[model samples]
Target: MKKSLICALVIYCFSSVAAYAAENPSVKALLSEMSKASQQLNYQLSYIVINRNTIEPLRYSHAVENNVQLAHLVYLSGPMREIIRRGGEVSYIDSSSEPFTIRANYMVAPTIPLLNSNINELSKYYDFVLLGKAREAGATCQVLRVVSKDGMRYSYVLWVDEKTKLPLRADLVDRDGDILEQFRTISLAVGDGVSKALGELQNVQLPQVLSLPQGNLTHTYWKVSWVPNGFKPEELNRYKLSGTNQMVESQLYSDGLFDFSVYVSDRNDQSLKSQLVRQGRRSLQIYVSGKNEVAVIGDIPPETALRIARSVKFSPVAAKKVADSNAVNNSPETDVAPESSSQ
Candidate 1:
């Protein structure tokens, strides 16, 4: 009797565990489905981007042909700007500049991580939660929230179609839960195969691929004293400023979703003072550290940007100089007694 009771208990426990797992699918599973659907499904999405006071309507379409991926995006109400991604190369066409192409895999659209990034990689920095259900873009959707674990990065709320597993709406929110930017789908169309127009786009003569000057692979001389969890240094390089043509040392950092760049330069432009400036959803923080000027720019809150700028710590050689300058500036001056005696 005792043995039979123990066996029954074990079976019940295993059944309960299996039921729970079935009811609650992992966040990674949901994201993986979204990623696969975005790539494999031939769909056209009409959406609008809302950043602060600016509202821009956009159109995006994706298709696969002969194992090659093709995507196109265009600003519906702008100065005539369009992006076409064919396989590994992306072409940009705009009224302000000549058409150009660059080597890239994914389309540079809003909510990039949701559309292209791997869920396993993004899970390192974010904690995903299933936020239940909603109706968006005339479809029943499952809402999911991706929050930064350390509060150093922005969070996102995504509404994905329940049937298609495609994203219908997304919101970029700050630490305080205020929405900074939003992408809302107006309409979406899924087809059995690639559209004829999109297929023909492959035959169009694309612009010559422009070769970007490579940055120096050497490490930077300075590092940040504090960074949010999962944040990692991406690259360190020196590049010339477009306006003044002045060389500047820059370091890039990312947490798989948001990216910020730190630039150190000798040129001190008073116009770019030690203050936070916000344009749309992006923020820029600029300050002077001893003789070098520092700038941090990204699509983050003002506080985050300011904190990153302040946390920058120079190398030992540079640290000493900065410390000495601070000491001299703060030291009280002594009286000139010898000058009085000579007079």
Candidate 2:
């Protein structure tokens, strides 16, 4: 009789686990629909990006034609700045610089978050939790939370429109549940007319893609000993800060949803022994170690940034390679620091 009871208990436990797993697919399906709708539908969204001290309004329109994606984003308040994406190339137009195009699949500027993110790829590191429903942007929407599995990274609360499945709002929140940055839609229009409006992009003449210089691949003695799982490093870079001209070496890492960069440089007069700063979705942490100053900065929590900065350690490499490169600014062939980019 005890054996039968134990068998029944085991079967019940397995069934409970199976039931819980089955429920997750529905939540993931909602997000999958949101991702598909963002890429497949012709829509227009007028939204405002809100931080602790600033609010910036913008408009974005997207459409897909002949298997080519077309998008345009315009800043409504600032000096006329716009990002235009036609197929795989994205062009930037603004008053400060001449119109230029870059090879990219999505607009890098601040737009609705997670519109083009890979739902399956993110599922590995994040948990999609359904948080019921709410009304947003004049429509009934489904509320969902994309929580980090490890709790070491920031999370997002998303409001997806029920009818259109388009994202209406997203909030980047810390582990303590404080919002760092918000993307809220003020108005949304879903129809083919939006596509018709963006169709003119085919006729607009965009500049050729700029030939971007590659990152400095020089091996360094400094190494980051630890990073959260799912984060992968890119090529190492050595460059001079445009203003201070401080020679620094940096390595950027990303986990598809977030990014952070580790910077190492010799201690100088301007070096700070310890500092931590958090602004919007970005955090910067700097600490002095021995004769070098290390910093970790990106869209992450302040504590994580500081931990990453502290985790950087010295690794002895070939003495000949260190000698050949000598110092950060010693080599004249090193590339200038490029603007920060996300995966």
Candidate 3:
């Protein structure tokens, strides 16, 4: 009887350990699988990006040949726009501009970070949670939620196909749980070999790579007063405006998932009026302060854009003094500097 009791206790303890080991997998594991599937599988995806007021249909195909990755994207509506990716170089073909190529590992598209970014790095700003399972695109999908820890960035709901381990749908949601934009796959086909069309696109002669003008990288005279949580300065450069051809100071910031560009230009007759514009998942906020015009544009909420725009500031002793004086006098309608020698 004593031996039987000891055996029963050991059996119970082993069963408990087995149950714990069989618990649901970690969110990071699921994301890692999705990332691997995106890069390793030969698949074609037809999807639609739905914004607040408009829906744009797009198609994407990815394949690998001789260990080289190739992908293509085409806008199914409106003007002709296409993108082709060969290895690390991406070429843009559009009706509005001449074809150009840029060096990037992944094409600029929704949920691209899942395919190219490290999950551990992104976890610095976002917390991933498994929200259970659902059916999407006629297949079982594991639903996951990515929430910002500080509420400075938007959150996302991702549906990853269980069978293929690929992303099926994603929704960008605001703090209030309102979905600002959504990407849903209408059809998906996976194969063991590259498609004939993808092989031809891989061999097509792409246009010359556009050289981006090098700018002074040491300039630190201007800075943003307030940055959202997890965001860091990516680059600061001076460039000529496309339309006005005026020299402008620009700063880029990113928080792993979202990116925004800030442009500070001398106030001119062509200066954009203070206004807010929302198109699809992007927002543009422009305001004029003294002799400087500030524009903040990104795929962020309008409120967040406005706050960032109001936080642009000048550095150093003299500029700070002038900025403080302006704040005290309340003479300007905006928070940016009246005029800075940095531009």
Candidate 4:
């Protein structure tokens, strides 16, 4: 009996060490390879996005020409929609939104997830665990899970092609382990041929990149007291509702991979009661403060959105100060006239 117990204890220790190694640097290295392969290789991915009862097919082609990244995405079946990326300029052509171009390194459309994500930064707040190999899109792929450290946000299960290091499929999972959406590749092609095919974009005329107005970062009356570990707040934006002309304030927070926005507005008949709603990968939570409504919306768990909404704090004096500052900034001279050195 004593001899058997000693053997079992030794086996457990070795197993624990092996598990640690598999979850740590090894997983991160694989993810790093995936990110590198995505940027360097000229490839095309034909995939489908499944969300609830809807399934949409799309095609994405990416290439690097003259050291500049170029990509194109097209909706395969629906009304004509295409997103083109020529280096830093990304143009969106869709029926719903006006055709426009923006200066951005990555296309914000529904392309492959984590294609350009910063793996080093995400590893700080999430753990990457290897789940061995699986077959996806007619290729042998390595499987992994990106789990949240605090279990307060969603997670992802990814299948990456073993030979090419390209992501083949990714599923967004909520806290309860239910899949909210999935991106699965139906076919893939990689080589210089794909690059030559996309070279025609060099001469394709794209719209001028829009110059977005800078947001005023002045402090506001409302404050979000708490957020997830890696989340960081962005600039505050103040605006008015179109028809009602009611003033509203909003600030966006991001943790590199996921982001959410907090909105504060005076409570009125249109203000929704405290509630939480989650659809696909988006969660929206509204909380009623004294005379204000705090809403948290983004790609987080419902519980997390609720907690963020509840943690908001507001002050009446600060509100007045912000209002006065906005009034001065909106004055006719400042709005309609360019700056002068003498003024």
Candidate 5:
């Protein structure tokens, strides 16, 4: 009997250690390493951006030599719109539109942040529990389920390449069980063979980014009346355009794993609004009526978007009714909402 008891204890000890290791692996460390590697290492990626309205396979070639981060994106089929990003600025020369320039952060750059940076804020809205071992990008990886803490943002499943600590694929879903976005690694490389032209931009000067002076924002400006419990804040900044006088109040909120952006404006006479746009895995919704206009942009199920859109209320109304309630943003004024959306 004593022998049997000893064996049971050994098994239990091993199980406990395994459980701890699964949850305690260096997520932050691995992610930091991945970010550093992408910026300092030389590599190339060939992936497909499968959007709802279109599916165009694309390739990105990047090289980081001598402290420069240079990369470009080229579509395989359709009109080839090329974007070259170097250092802190990005220039896009598209076949459809005139070339333009903009300052961008390494996190939410236009092409795709999934490749350029680490999802550091993911833990705020998700429990990054290990789903055990897996294989991806011709290397070992850990399968992690970025489960959502609330309905405001969607859940994500990710395959983090074990060797490189880079995310191989990510799936975006909604509350009613739908995939709003899927970024998979069809092929990836780690070693040399990076071309200098990948980061090369035509020797053309770009206009200085427009500065409206009121572009700076703080947490005080985003006194949200309501947000899902686990939804993390993804971004909050102003969008200032040249040759325009209207200034916008912008905010971004996410649940660590899932994310969304909200824009508030004093109803411009654009003559169009209260609509949503579905771009492949990405989605954009505009809520406009009377003198108020709000735009919620992200990649989540349409129903979730609708719920989030309706849940938004002005600060004035939030103060009047939700003094005692926990959710001042989701007050009674937004009770009636959409039932479904085709997108």
Candidate 6:
């Protein structure tokens, strides 16, 4: 009996060890390769970013020099939003809204080298898994699943070029298996970095991007009692739409990979009480008659957006002390965990 028990125990131990090793194989290598492809490779790509009702195809060129990444992004089909970023500084030339220059945070989404945090830092919320090979974008591609590590966030899958390790397509999906957005490359080149490819977009003029001035009286800050962990405020500005006397304050928040913008406007037409579902992304704009309204937009689910918006309560003093206002209950200690080699 004792001999049989010992044999079973040994077999179980070996099986457990084998399972763990198999589960983590090449995670570190795959992550490193993906980062190299995004951070160092020189590539010109024509890709598509698709939401449910909207489809946009744009061309992208990137270069890396001395460990600095230079990229130029332009919208191909819509109001031209031209942007150039090197290292941490960003310059924008968008003709859509007032044509003002703004400094974008390095970690904001749709921007590479997201928030200066690499795949390692974001891996806390998601896992990197290698799927079987496939053919895409006129080249062999490897599919990688960035599975959500927690229920608080969404998951993503990327189809990366096998030879270059450049992501040809990225699909963002919710827990219900619905794709929220899809980004894919239509064509690509793998040899040089973005700095070398600068010649391609050399003729394009980038508008002057300046940092936001301090003590802006127009911007208002509403002190929220709670926000989801991993979210941080990045920028704030105020505007009034033409043809109407409505006023609004736009505030952008980011959590390295994901960003959410909250727009505060007047309660004209009860905009907040009625659900606003545009571009297939559900959003909640909370407004009280004559009181300030809030529109929360991000890649998050509608329920999550609603929760955040509903939880917002104005502290009367925040408007005057916008710069000093602190986000409540969502500090890194309570939200983000220590970074370590786990895979």
Q: Per-residue alpha-carbon lDDT of model 2 for 1-343, expressed as tens digits?
A: 9999999999999999999766434778999999999999999999999999999999999999899999999999969999999999999999998999999897879988889989998999999999888999889988999999988899999999988999999999999899989999999998989999999999998899999877755456677877877898987877778877466788889888899989888788878879988777898999898878999999988888888888877643432344355454486344332323222
Clashes of each: 0, 0, 0, 0, 9, 9
Cα lDDT of model 1 by residue, 1-343, tens digit? 9999999999999999999778667777988899999988899989998988888899898888889998999899969999999999999899999999999896566633488767888888788999888999999988899987777778889998878889999999888788888999999999955466589889999899889866533444456776666667765665556776454667777776777888776635543557778885688999777766788998767888889888876565543443354356542221211111110
Better of 3 and 6 by TM-score: 3
The list of candidate 4 runs beyond 4 A from truth reads 1-25, 324-343
TM agreement with the true structure for every prediction? 0.83, 0.86, 0.81, 0.88, 0.65, 0.68
RMSD of each: 9.8, 5.8, 6.4, 5.8, 9.4, 8.9
Model 2 residue 304 distance off true place after TM-score fit, in angstroms: 0.3
Candidate 4 residue 4 Cα shift, in angstroms, is 22
Residue lDDT tens for model 5, 126-245: 555566777865778777666655544566666777766666666665565566556666787766556545434434465455333332333322234455665555444544345764
lDDT of 1 at 179: 89
Order the candidates by lDDT, highest first — what do you get? 4, 2, 3, 1, 6, 5
Query: By the lDDT metric, which is better: model 4 or model 5?
Result: 4
**Better-scoring candidate (TM-score), 2 or 5:** 2
How far does residue 231 in candidate 2 sit from its true spot (Å)? 1.5
Alpha-carbon local distance difference test for all models: 0.77, 0.85, 0.78, 0.85, 0.59, 0.62
- What's the lDDT for residue 216 in model 3? 41
Q: In candidate 5, residue 192 scores what lDDT? A: 57
Q: Which numbered prediction scores highest in TM-score against the true structure?
A: 4
Q: Which of 4 and 6 is ahead in lDDT?
A: 4
Candidate 2 lDDT for residue 271:
86
Q: Runs in model 2 with CA error above 4 Å?
A: 1-25, 216-218, 243-245, 316-324, 327-329, 332-343
Worst 10-residue lDDT window for candidate 2 reads: 334-343
* C-alpha positional error of residue 249 in candidate 6 after TM-score superposition, expressed in Å: 5.0
